[model samples]
Target: MNKLNVLFLTLSSMENINERGIYTDLVRELASRGIYIHVVFPRERRLGLPTELEIIDNIKLLKVKTGNITETRFIEKGISTLTIENQYLKAVKKYFGNINFDLIIYSTPPITFERVIQYLKKKHQSKTYLILKDIFPQNAVDIDILKNNSFIWKYFRNKEKHLYEVSDMIGCMTKGNVQYILNHNPYIDRNKVEVFPNSIEPIDRNNISIINNEIKEKFQIPAHLTLFIYGGNLGKPQGIDFLIRVAENFYKIENSYLLIVGSGTEYETIKNYIDSRHPKNVNLIKSLPKKEYDQLLRSADVGLIFLDKRFTIPNFPSRLTSYFEYSLPVLAATDKHTDLKNILIESNSGFWCESGDLDSFIHLAKSLADNNVLRKQMGLKGRDYLEDNYDIRKTANIIMKHL
Candidate 1:
């Protein structure tokens, strides 16, 4: 059989060989399955890439420069809009103009790429897949980041609809997301929308165990303490304020520690709280390399997931893969309807608590810490679940069947 040529478009800042991003993992999985993948990503200021293209394994990676402006302040939001739009247009013209693909799969956060997809579909007669990773305008509305009836909402909503209309198929990360899309746009074909959950490559426990002791020592994690590690974005969507509160409540627990290992908008806030409180059990670290993070996760006693209660659509955090890969039982704190809660309970791999319930969260953590046998049993269940469900080879086969 002739392998399909896939062109993946994403607005992510950078791609490292082992670091997991949706586009990065998908391209690698596809390449490993004999499909040829060419990826084009935005070359933002923070991302340093070679001028000449590079190939990793069998996949080609091309970085096109974007606007140099940094929008960290409230006043810069308007400037960011103009800057990003211009940069995306320039990137499309410079890098994507010459390429023709059998299929184009684009991930979204910034919906400005709708125009690019529309152009690609007409030019190449390709099937376009809109991998809806984030519900943008709606998420903004849910969090009061944007008013539902405001001009910004109306403008972006139109763009959102157009992006949906141009795509041949829409792949959502959860069933709730698929339903949300369908409910919002009743005219969209039900058959064209489907759930494609995040997946991970299997890890060899022997290889992981080799670095386990070193990772724990490097982090200054005590051998006797139960480490509950949260290893992803520290952002508003994570309800990091709630996490900080939980940390404050449990600061005195000698047998337990909360190790937070990532950076985002809320990093400074959490750092400040830790400094002021001087919590011996709460440790904050910047994001580490993927291998380091994976090793630490493997060594840790438990993995944590947190999502803001404000999020209406089910957010299945991609970080769950690391926990499952290492057979580390999860402690998911999110809204009531999240898809992750169901997965955790069904797999018997972890426990879930309502977001912002500090009392319940603390109790759950204490239970996990006190009951070593139960924790080990749950971890084993998660390992078995990952082997049966999230193996990259098996997931790639399912994706190829769709193609």
Candidate 2:
């Protein structure tokens, strides 16, 4: 067997490898499976470190400087993502100039990696694969961030198309995403797209048990109230306005309570709602440490997920992994475009409601909250579904097969 060299391009921060994350786990899996892996990602000025190389175990990671794109406003994010290319290109050549990579794997968010991908592909004659985590300009259009065919729209849209064109194959996060690409962009060959769901290293639940009262007491969460928690990015992409509407609907319900955690661009928007409304049944915690957050999930009764109704592109959030990891049942409100709702229904692991349907969401959420036996049954199914489908080992095998 020939030993293979791989280059991973991503926008994820590698500052803390000890903390578990999606991309880190995937790369680690590949490394462990006897694949030679090299990762490149941005290092912010806030870390106060020069552009440098770090090696962990056998995997090589190069951290280069880039603008603060995440956790910022729209204009800043645009500039940061676009400007990251030059920095990434320089770093790629500085370190990897002599090496011949077998496969170049990358993810989207900053589709500005076109030049680097094209450069490396030509140099090494490498197989390029895009882990298409997002479909951008259309998402921007959905959220009113960009006007149709505007200068900025044309720029990013062209970049998106070019990235697709350059990739040897495109791995989508869902079946809906695959179809969205093929459906809208008739120019793309149907053979180029396939489902590549977000995967994680499944957590051990053998020693875990519901500490019903301990966490509830500590957090001042009521013992009798059925907790419905949303514990990921709280932002426009999540349809915060609709989330506020959902919370408002349940504010007066005695048995149901809502817990909103995580922070993002729209954190202040959520914070203000909580302060002004001061609803009895809703608690908005800004954010929590990952360990504490895991503890909270283990204690919670239900996990909640949301996506903006306006999205024409299917968006899958990885927070579903945390819910499945704890054997907690989920209730998702999503746009029709994503088939996570379908998967949840098919697995019998959770309930789903259309993003725009407050009445249906309220009905399902209340029905699930009222039935402990049903919730427990679904939670068990969720664990089975996650293990069978999304285990990182399986994900690694899938990518390796393509390689």
Using TM-score as the measure, which candidate wins?
Answer: 2
Using lDDT as the measure, which candidate wins?
A: 2
Per-residue lDDT of model 1, residues 1-403, tens digit only: 6767787777664457456654566677788777878777656555564434567766877776654333254235435544565555555567556767788888876676788778777888988888788877887777677899799788888888888899888888878789888997998999999876676677676666553577888878887788899998887789887888878887645498789999877889999988888776789998898778877887788899998888887777888878887878899889876778888989999999999998888888888888889888998899888888767666566567656
Per-residue lDDT of candidate 2, residues 1-403 (tens digit): 5788899999988766556778888998998888888899998756667888888876888999888877888898888898899999899899877889999999988788898999999999999999998788888899898999999899998999899989998999888889888998999889878878788888777756736468778778888888889998887899998898887778645598899998899999888887998867888887888778888888888999999988878788899877887888999998887888888989999999889799898888878888999999999999899898888888888789877
All candidates: CA RMSD (Å): 2.4, 1.7
Count of clashing residue pairs in every prediction = 0, 0
**How much is 181 displaced in model 2, in angstroms?**
0.9
TM-score of each: 0.92, 0.95
Query: lDDT, candidate 1, residue 287?
Result: 88
Whole-model Cα lDDT per candidate? 0.77, 0.86
The collision pairs in model 2 are none
Instruction: Give per-residue lDDT, candidate 2, residue 136.
Output: 87
Question: Model 1: runs farther than 4 Å from truth?
Answer: 18-21, 47-52, 68-89, 209-211, 252-254
Candidate 2 Cα lDDT to native:
0.86
